[model samples]
Target: MGRQSPFLLQIGVFILFFILQAATMRDRIIGGREAKPHSRPYMASIQFKGKNICGGALVNRIWVMSAAHCFDNLRPESMQVVLGAHSVTAQEPSQQNFTVQASISHPNYNMETLENDIHLLKLNKAALVNDFVRKISLPKQGEDVTPRRKCIIAGWGDTTDFETHPKALMETNTEVVSRASCNSSWTGSISQHMVCATSPDNVKRGFCSGDSGAPLVCMNRAVGVVSFSSFRCANPRFPDVYTRVSEFISWMEDVMRSF
Candidate 1:
């Protein structure tokens, strides 16, 4: 069985409802620079009503990986996935849009702590594989992200809750923080199914509003899904948490096989 609904889950100081507001969502990379077009080919914009809602990773032609919390009160018909997109506001010829066919949130996902926070999105049709749009490789089962391993996160979430306008996709370099260190910041806030990442010294950068479900790529493999961060946005004191992909490989593969 699944956990209780978290549509009201307070996220990044923005009410969950506010983050899902319609109109359009833009690139919200805080303390990060604009990403070159297709530089991260597997990056995906999970849009709702043509507006960016969450970040996702194209794991295969027909599937995308994201945070389960993103689906709260969100219907598949109202959502679409944008591939090969650079600017959230501008549509490029390389961009391909697909209607979402289904959203499968993990049955055991916990709303309070965001455990098993991962989710899989099935597309109505297989994505077109090309230079600008491609699939990210998943980690082998039991694979682990070493502490302080450098990684990258990209997204089009809100720079601030009030900045609703879209901008070009932004990305930042971050590193895995030790579980013990991360736990110290949250104090029993993180679970075994999750991992944490933080920007380097004095950088004070991390995920923020509208960045949920973003991918945490390390060693050229998709290792985690952006789960949550400090409500204050990149507060260096609290590293952002992500759904550990390696821990859910069986669940992911099982879902794919069922499809």
Candidate 2:
């Protein structure tokens, strides 16, 4: 259910079959369920004008992390970040909102292959951190873990294809798979910059359309940034792809410190 970014996707099959995928409407969760309010405090709802556009996270008081595609060609002045929120459309008393001052996506971001699909949003002012508005810890640079580890992904994206997305945040448990396994399943579709995760037994428990740029949290650390699911969401063999967060730690530190 991943849409082609305005940027080019260099893969041949993606280019040849891109039109077919584009015709489908953005989809969402299949077997994932509702999440508790404020449970994922660092969660940030990236909005354009007044509508939710993507999921992001507060890495620090004034910096947000999300997929570059979500912000590509979008004006920062028209964007906002909503923290401490469970519902995408609702405004809550406990939530803190901030106007985006600016944003920068990875220099090498490729829409075609979804390589380096990360970005950072700078908030005009530091958010007032509180019980429900704290930042999530990031993984150490170059961190590595064996596959089959369990992780959780949360978002306000759809719960099923063609259905209205839930107002409340939805979450699902997914397992990390080895790159070799992922590559074999997609056959040249997996990129080095991407990490893979999915549900076992073909259960409909995976990220879907509108779930892009969401956080993939493991062991209380932000391990990956939701990149995109393949042509379909929650498919048994085609796991969801993510921008590995650990690999970008150096870039993130440099970006935050520079600006």
Model 2 agreement with the true structure over 124-156: per-residue lDDT tens digits: 999989888989899888886469999998887
Which candidate tops TM-score? Answer: 2
Per-candidate local distance difference test: 0.83, 0.83
Question: TM-scores for all candidates?
Answer: 0.87, 0.89
RMSD in Å for model 2: 7.3
Candidate 2, which segments miss by more than 4 Å at Cα? Answer: 1-27
- State the local distance difference test value for candidate 2: 0.83
**C-alpha RMSD in Å of predicted model 1 compared with the true structure:** 7.9
Give the per-residue lDDT digits (tens) of candidate 1, residues 9-48.
Answer: 4454475455454333333556777788789999899987
**Residue pairs in candidate 2 whose N, alpha carbon or C atoms collide under 3 angstroms:** 8-112, 9-112, 29-158, 29-159
